[model samples]
Target: MFLNTILNSIIQIIFFAALPFIWWLLSARKRIPFTQWIGLKPWKDRSTHLGVWIAGISAAFTAVGLALLFAFQGTETAVSVFSGRGIQAVPAVAVYAVLNTSFPEELLFRGFLLKRLQAQFGFVAANITQSLLFGLLHGALFLGTAGVGKTVLLVLFTAAIAWFMGYINEQKADGSILPSWIIHAVSNLVSGLCAAYGVL
Candidate 1:
C-alpha cells in the first residue's frame, strides 16, 4: 500500500507536468524557459514580506485545521493513500506529500493554468476558473470515499485555498509559486503524518 501510494502520487505529478509541457511545446517550445515560465523561480523579495507571511501562515493553518477535523472523524472522509498504513509509512508519505503531491499541483494550477487564464481573461476570472477546476478535480477524486457532504465541503475548501494561493503568488510573491508551494507542502506533510498514524 505504501509503494502504491508513492506510485499514485508519481502518476499525478506526471500528469500535472505533462499538461504544461505540452503547452510549452506547442507555444514557446524552447524559447521561454519552462521552469521560470511555470513560476519555478526561487524566492522573490516580497516572498518574505509581512503580507506574504500572513497569507502563507493563515492558509497553512486553515488547511491543517481542516485536515485535523477529518482526522478526528477517522472516517472515509479522511482520504489519503497512506491511510491505515501506520507509522511505517510516515517517512515515505512525508516525502511524497511535499515533493510529489504539493509541488506538482502548485506548478500546474497556480503556475500554469492560472497564468494562462490570467493572460486570456485577467486575474479575477482566471483565478476563479482555475480554482473551480482545482476544486472539481479534487471533488472527483474524493467523491467515492468522502461522500456527498464531505466532497462538497472539500470542493469549496479546495477552491478557496486555490484562489488564495493564486492571489498570494500574483500579488505578494511576484508571481512566484514559492509561497503557495511552501504552504501546500506543509499542509500535505501534516495531513500525511496524521494519515500515517491512522488518524485520518
Candidate 2:
C-alpha cells in the first residue's frame, strides 16, 4: 500500500507540475512569460505581498488553527493521509502532499484560473467561481471516505477559506500566489503529520 501510494503520488506530482505549462501552451497560447503568468516571480512588493509579514505568516497559522478546530469539534472527515499508516509514512506524506497537492493547487487555482477569470470578469465573480471549483474538488476527493454531510460542510468551509486565499493573492500578494502557497504548503505539512500521527 505504501509503495502504491508513493508511486501514485509521484505520478500526480509530475502531472500537476506539468499542468501550468500545459495551460500555457494550450489555453494561454504562451503570450506572457510562463513564470510571470503563473505568478511565480519574486516578491513584487513587500508592502503588499508579504511586506506586512503578518499576511503570509497568519495564513499558515490560520490554516493550522482551522484544521485543529475541525479535528477537535467540527465535522470529522477522513483524508487519504488520515490512514493509520504508522510514522514511516509521515515524511513521504508530507513531501508528497506539499508538492503534489498544495503547490499545484495554488498554481492552478489562484495563479492560473483565478487570474484568467479575474481578467474576463471581476474579482468577486472570479473568486467565487474558483473557490467553488476548489471546494468541489476537495468534496469530491473526500466524499467516498467522508460521507455526504461532512462533505457538504467541508465544501462550504473550503470554499469560504479559498475565497479568502484568493483575496490575499490579489490584494495582499500583489497577484502572486506565494502567500496562499505558503499557507497551503504549511497546512498540508501539518495535516499530513497530524494524520500520520493519528491526531486527526
Candidate 3:
C-alpha cells in the first residue's frame, strides 16, 4: 500500500507538472489564447490582506477538521499524532508536498481545468465541475476496494475543500492561484505529518 501510494503520487505529480506545457502546445497549434487555457492573469491591484487571512484560517480549519474526523473514526491515536514520527517526517513531507503536490495540483485543477470549463460553461458550472473532478482524484485512496466509508468521506471532504479553493480563486482580483496553493500545501503538509505518525 505504501509503495502504491508513492507511485501514484509520483505519477500524478509528473502528469500535472507537464500539463501547462501540453496546453501551451495545443494553444499554439489551435490559436487559442494561453491565458484562456491556463488562466494566467497578471497580478492586479487588490487588497491581499483578506486573501492572506482567508488562506491561513481556511487551511487551519481544514487541517483541524480532517484531524478531528479521523480521530473520531478511531483510525488514528492522538498521542502518537504529536510525537516523534510526526516531528521527524513533517519537514521532508512538507517540502515534497509543496513542490510536487500543491503547486502542480493547483495549476492543473484551478488554473487549467477551471479556465477550460469557464470557456465552455459559465463560472458557476465550471467551479462545480472542477470541484467534482478534484474529489474523484482523491478517490485514488480507495484503490484496494475496501474502506468504502473512508473513501466516501474523503471524497466529500475533498470536494468541499475544492469548492472553497475555487471560491477563493474567483474572488481574487488577478485570479491568482497562490492563495489556494498555499492553503493546499499547508493542509497537505499537516496531513502528511499526521500520516507518518499514524494519526490519519
Candidate 4:
C-alpha cells in the first residue's frame, strides 16, 4: 500500500506537469509563451503582499474543507492515509501534499486548462469548465469510498472553491497564479493536519 501510494503520487505529478505542454502542442495554435499562459508573471502586488492574502484565504478554505469532511463522514478514510505512520512522516506528507498534489493540480486545472479553455470559450465557459474538471478530479479521490451523495457534495464544494479561486485570479488585469497555488497548498496542509489528528 505504501509503495502504491508513492507510485500514485509520482504518476499524478508527472501527468499533471506534462499535460499542459502536450495540450499546447496538439490543440493550441497560438504562439503563447508557457509562462504567460500559465500566469507565472507578476500581478497587482509583490509576492509578500499576495502571500498575506493567501494565508487568510487558505485558512477559510481549510475550515470549509474540514467541515465537509465530517459532513461526509470521511474521517476514517482520511485518517487512515496518514494515521499509523509516525509523526516523523508528517512533514514529508505535508511537503508531498503541497508540492505534488496542490501545486500540480492548480497548474493543470487553473493555470493550463483554464487558460486553454478561455481561448476557445468565453470566460464564463472557461471558468465553468475548469471548475467541473476540478470537481471531477476530487470526485476520483473522494467518491469511490464515500458513496454518491457525499461525494457529490464534496465535488460541488470543491468546484465552487475553484470558481472563487479563478475569480480571484482574474480580479486584477494581469492574473497571477501564486495566490491560488498558495491557498491550495495551505488547504491541503490543513486537511492533512485534521486527518493526522483525527479531528474530523
What are the lDDT scores of the predictions, listed in order? Answer: 0.76, 0.72, 0.66, 0.73
Residue-by-residue lDDT tens digits, candidate 2, 1-200: 45655676677756765867787888666477887888886666745436555355556555744564464343453244444676788767766656656777887889888998999999999999999999999788767766788778778877887887898788766788887777776666666666666665
Write down the lDDT that model 1 would get: 0.76
lDDT for model 2, please: 0.72
Give the lowest summed-lDDT range of ten residues in model 2.
71-80
Q: List, residue by residue over 1-200, the lDDT tens digit for candidate 3.
A: 33444565677767885877686786664775655446545545467775676666566646755654563454442222333465565655656556656777888988888867876897899989998899888666453442666667667777878877877776663566766777777776666676677655
Better of 3 and 4 by lDDT: 4
Question: 1-200 in candidate 4: lDDT tens per residue?
Answer: 34554676688778887978777667553877777777777676655765666666787778778788678663355435765455655775676566757777878887887777887897789988899889888877866677898878888888988887776676632567777877887787767766666565
The regions of model 2 sitting more than 4 angstroms off are 1-10, 17-19, 26-30, 47-87
C-alpha-based local distance difference test score of model 4: 0.73
TM-score head-to-head 3 vs 4, winner: 4
Clashes of each: 0, 1, 0, 0
lDDT of 2 at 154: 70
| TM accuracy, model 2 | 0.77
Q: In what order do the candidates fall by TM-score, top score first?
A: 1, 4, 2, 3
Number of the top TM-score candidate: 1
TM-score of every candidate? 0.82, 0.77, 0.72, 0.80
Worst 10 contiguous positions by lDDT, candidate 4: 74-83
